[model samples]
Target: MPTRKIRRTQLLALAVAALTVPATAALAAPVPADAAAAPTAPLAAPATTASTTTAPATAVAASPTGFLNLPTSLLPTDRAPHEISFQYRNDSAGDQSIAPQVLIESPVGGPFLVPTAVSLQVETSDGSWLPLPLGIETGTLYTNLIPAKLVLHSHHTLTEHYRLTVLSPSLGTVAPRIAFYG
Candidate 1:
């Protein structure tokens, strides 16, 4: 019941640390075209030309919606008989981006799901849909209670989270409750 720190960057780091993405894959969000021209800017690509397979980073957001309003409860879990509810929230704002996170609780040694993938929708207030940069955070948890692979076997309660994000505030209100995997 202690208050958990909600620093999205650190929290996202924790989430990223848990994931198992191959080291060779590109993990950096694309640099904006304007920023790419500046040699002093970090992530300033040597070349702005995107590969045929990839869209330019600027193209990722069209007509550029000003910015997102922070912290919306997009998904609600049915905790049922359990006392704690699973909750999802947008943890990013302004130039900072952290994938939205879902806080989870499962009984130790019990069969449970750690989501491998999930899906969501985003739409404008006017009802037009927008493309979402979607990803499911996956990683291992390391500690005494959690083993090397992050599997649970102890008697203590486990509360952890993973990252998921919807790009636009236009995120739709109607969707099935988010589900998980083992």
Candidate 2:
């Protein structure tokens, strides 16, 4: 397979390019109160008016986690495999949940012609990698939802490493996009 590994910068660029979220519905991580304090020299305190009401602090909007990480390049059909790692974090003040799925896009502008066999494995808590129960067989675009849900607590991060094997010679060289929703 004619494949090349994508650098971290390139992977991030590709992820940003491929994923699109609307402005209104986007969620941002709240800034810590201490970090929001501005540094100022000795200044006279302004007189507080009894009738004035303090405006509530506004929270800055941002994405707590980034796009799901997958290898930009897969190993050749005969090679053992390659390991890739990514971190998912919850920067929001509250817990966040997500379910992951695989999205395969047509390589050519035309319809997909062959079924791609993909094998995926996820790392376990014991520092061991285990194969996930996922199977895909199709010629057109499709999504294979992984049977797992991850809940990240505030200011916490979950690190994961995974290996992907694509059996379809035509698709082995193509990178698959991992999507997280809900």
Per-model tally of clashing residue pairs: 5, 1
lDDT per residue (tens digit) for residues 134-155 in model 1 = 3322221111110111211212
Name the candidate that leads on lDDT: 2
Whole-model Cα lDDT of every candidate shown, in order: 0.25, 0.38
lDDT tens per residue, model 2, 1-182: 22222212232233233233333122221112232132121111111123255545443222222234344453345535556566554455554554333333344453352433555555555556565433233333222222233444555665556666555534433333222332
Model 2 TM-score on a 0 to 1 scale: 0.45
Candidate 2 ranges with C-alpha deviation above 4 Å: 1-78, 102-106, 109-116, 135-146, 172-182
Q: Which candidate number maximizes TM-score?
A: 2
